[model samples]
Target: MQIPTAAASGRSRLLTSGVALAALSLLLTLHAVPSAADDDTPARGTASMGSGVLAHEGVHGQPAATDRTTQTEGVDVSSHQGEVAWSTLWNSGVKWAYVKATEGTYYRNPYHAQQYNGAYDVGMIRGAYHFATPDTAGGAAQADYFVDRGGAWSKDGRTLPGVLDIEYNPYGDTCYGMTHSQMVGWIRDFLDRYKARTGRNAVIYTSTNWWQQCTGDYSGFASTTPLWIARYASTVGPLPAGWTFHTMWQYTSTGPVVGDHDKFNGALDRVKALAEG
Candidate 1:
């Protein structure tokens, strides 16, 4: 048997060390890079109310104390909230709620019944909202899907009209790849179809910046459609061009409860009035 020289043994040790270092570097690179599926962006047809708002505007401090005193407290929830604690929320002074019902024509909240009915069971005025995805289907088609699923409205004095959550697109382009005119037309189609199906005007939920960018600040719907302006601030700030006032304001994404906090523009009685309508 031949004996190995010290130089040969040293060379072998260096080569082994080099291989181990390469493996360690590779492992670290893999750990640092995020996979496509690991993206926090919600899947298609699963985007919920304020999904884009939280992504875009981030969470702000609570609304002004004076603002809170005059307006009715509410919340908006999605499947992300799962089965909500409606009773706890009611005890927390939440007077109303909007539960996500559908998204485009592809997705519906599996927990819709629990959240929607649960809120009502707790003596809170509850309504459903549809997360609009114009790129997936026509506005009218999505509206039909919404109403069929859970967005339907009746003047039962405990339910408010459904809302069209039209804001920053979680999937792709900010305006869902449509021109300003096209975006406006698509929204009009959704609102008109929803009204035709439910005999009530669907509330339009959007941020001022998103409305300005996507719809060219169109004022055509201001007269008929109720606006639910999203602004995570102490005040609502400037509204979209034609809306002199917002019916509801989503004030904060990080509320103490299960979902985003909102405020009706008036007292608790006004909220009941909106429900009656």
Candidate 2:
């Protein structure tokens, strides 16, 4: 999608507000990748507005209000971040990064190789995420596509497992036209295939509202799947059925780092363990 740029002054103000709000949410509620190809780019999409701004909101049309806070063990990035200073990020205490590698079934972040490997080179635990496009393809098909591109992983201690970004559908139909049971099956297909392929379950990224609205608030995955909850609130609040606690909490959309700010719910050792099998 072609996002029209506003006049320099207005654009600057909007972007600045977006960045500031994103950072503030962190201090207040806490908070909250990648390069792709020309043809592979998803139409710049925005999140449904309500309580808090989606990290991926703004930039396409206008800047979004973001949660701002401090404390950054991890961050997720996509093409929107452009060129990142991985070493700088590492030096500033960013130990882990989740980079956007694939979306739907075909779109691949052309910058996957750079961001994924660059973070690894700097000794940071690195992982890649696939934006689910359940509306466009079945779960297994998209899982296969993601693994082939960005989901592939190595047993190295610093390489994190693949992630499934299953929040809002950027295209249309937030639930992808699937009923609650169907949504559960679709996610199960993706998760099961991913585990079979890499011998590790993919981490789930989503908000409580999205999960409830789309998946009927299924908690079955809580026993086996690691939860990465996104909420710009002081506390995580009510979570999906199965998850007792979030393994990761995304607090803000902007931070000292280049992407959305995140916390790994534990110490460096735990983060390393998460990175390992």
Candidate 3:
């Protein structure tokens, strides 16, 4: 499926971006990403496909995996649709889920409400929402939009901090595509507003390219405002300089989620505590 964009590099997709080209290397390195070995996690009653792989949503669980899971890694289960959500994920042992609450300019995730309700129903804590912010949308407005669609920061049992989906599209064929500083600014703006409204630090979800080429100072940000790195790999080569700890990892693309289809997700361990706080 086609994911939305946050950068303005003039390309319909980021096939040419350094980040995009390196995406495969990154995802393959995710500690829990799927591979050719461990087909699926053995669940009690779920029917398994003859392949010895578990059937979920439309895809089958692969044996070889690094660390993150299709169901537990990314945003809300809403990302996957038309299938058993709560039950499947609950059975699959998902730790947390980030729901795509909103998108650029004017799009809120169609499944935001239902997915939120589903997570609530299953009692999966450590929830977060991603905003497809535009490079040209400016900081303050985008930040406000994030909260506007990010659901209740304090109301819905406390969220695990907000995330900024910074990739391509928003800036769209801009002069130099999207620079590192731009993404940093985007995160800074979003976090500032969120903190002002909720009185808490926000998390930053970025790829290695953005962090390496753009970021230099994460020290100013709170330690608790953990980084959610999106690399789909078995090993992260080496932690990029300057960063300390990450909260989530979008380790793979070969994922199987029940319903619409759970694309792009990661591992979330501290999700519960962060959301509760």
Candidate 4:
């Protein structure tokens, strides 16, 4: 995989430094993101959805807006969800699942096969995701590692594209110690490599706050990649700079199943189209 060496050569140094310092300071003040290895269940109904104004209609345990927009409800899980009963989840009206496949450059989910395959076996549209660790390795290298593990996709119409979970670092340095431009370059590298290997862009999972503070509100990825906004509120909060709409919304961490509840932004057919890609 090729690494970008001079990603920000054309940008003015003064502007870059100012933005980077401000972003770093802001991230420092933000709370550390919860570790996926630990229970994120309680944070489900907590302020991750933001405080006050609950207006969404609950689907099973998922609460979203009552407005009649067609959506397919689903769930996202890591090993933290533990020994998922896919059939039971499927019977609960879940149409899809995004399973955590890999993290950083080294960790691959040990329960990936059981969770992912079981989801497929139970007739649910399935996808895999990489928990990005931009500080640990070059984006291209990490992307390669991710796809090699479970992030690759098939045009089977039942398999959704891989996802890049780029958000608050559960580790130190919320921005992963990279400037906005640098972070964007690393993400670009990963997306490029993933597309080259799998023939489709990966879905980007992020929160509004993280995108603004860490990525300097970069909007370039909006056009090519699909956004999966994780805002546990009555509505998706202000999205990252470019996205006019979210492709998927993760509404709650505490769901009917052993995972986070999510909704595809459109009808079942649209979700199938995404899977077909």
**Candidate with better TM-score, 1 vs 4:** 1
The number of clashing residue pairs in each candidate reads: 0, 28, 45, 3
Q: Which is the winner by TM-score between candidate 2 and candidate 4?
A: 4
Question: In candidate 4, what are the lDDT values of residues 23-105, reduced to their tens digit?
Answer: 99899769666677576333221212211112222232347865357889988888776679999999999989999888787
Of 1 and 2, the candidate ranking higher by TM-score: 1
lDDT of 2 at 48: 18
Which candidate has the top score in lDDT?
Answer: 1
Runs in model 4 deviating more than 4 A are 1-62
Candidate 2 residue runs with Cα over 4 Å from true position: 1-72
Candidate with top TM-score is: 1
Candidate 3 residues 177-206, lDDT tens each? 556566566667767777887776776655
Write down the lDDT of every candidate, Cα atoms only. Answer: 0.91, 0.77, 0.51, 0.82
Question: For candidate 1, what is the lDDT?
Answer: 0.91
lDDT tens readout by residue for model 1, 1-277? 9898999999999999999999999999988878888997767767877778878877764764656457889999998889998999999999999999999888989999999999999999999999999999999999999999999998899999999999999988899999999999999999999999999999999999999999999999999999999988888889999999999999888889779999999999999898888
TM-score each candidate. 0.86, 0.76, 0.62, 0.78
lDDT assessment of candidate 2: 0.77
142: Cα error in model 4, Å: 0.8
- Ranking of all candidate structures by their TM-score, best first: 1, 4, 2, 3
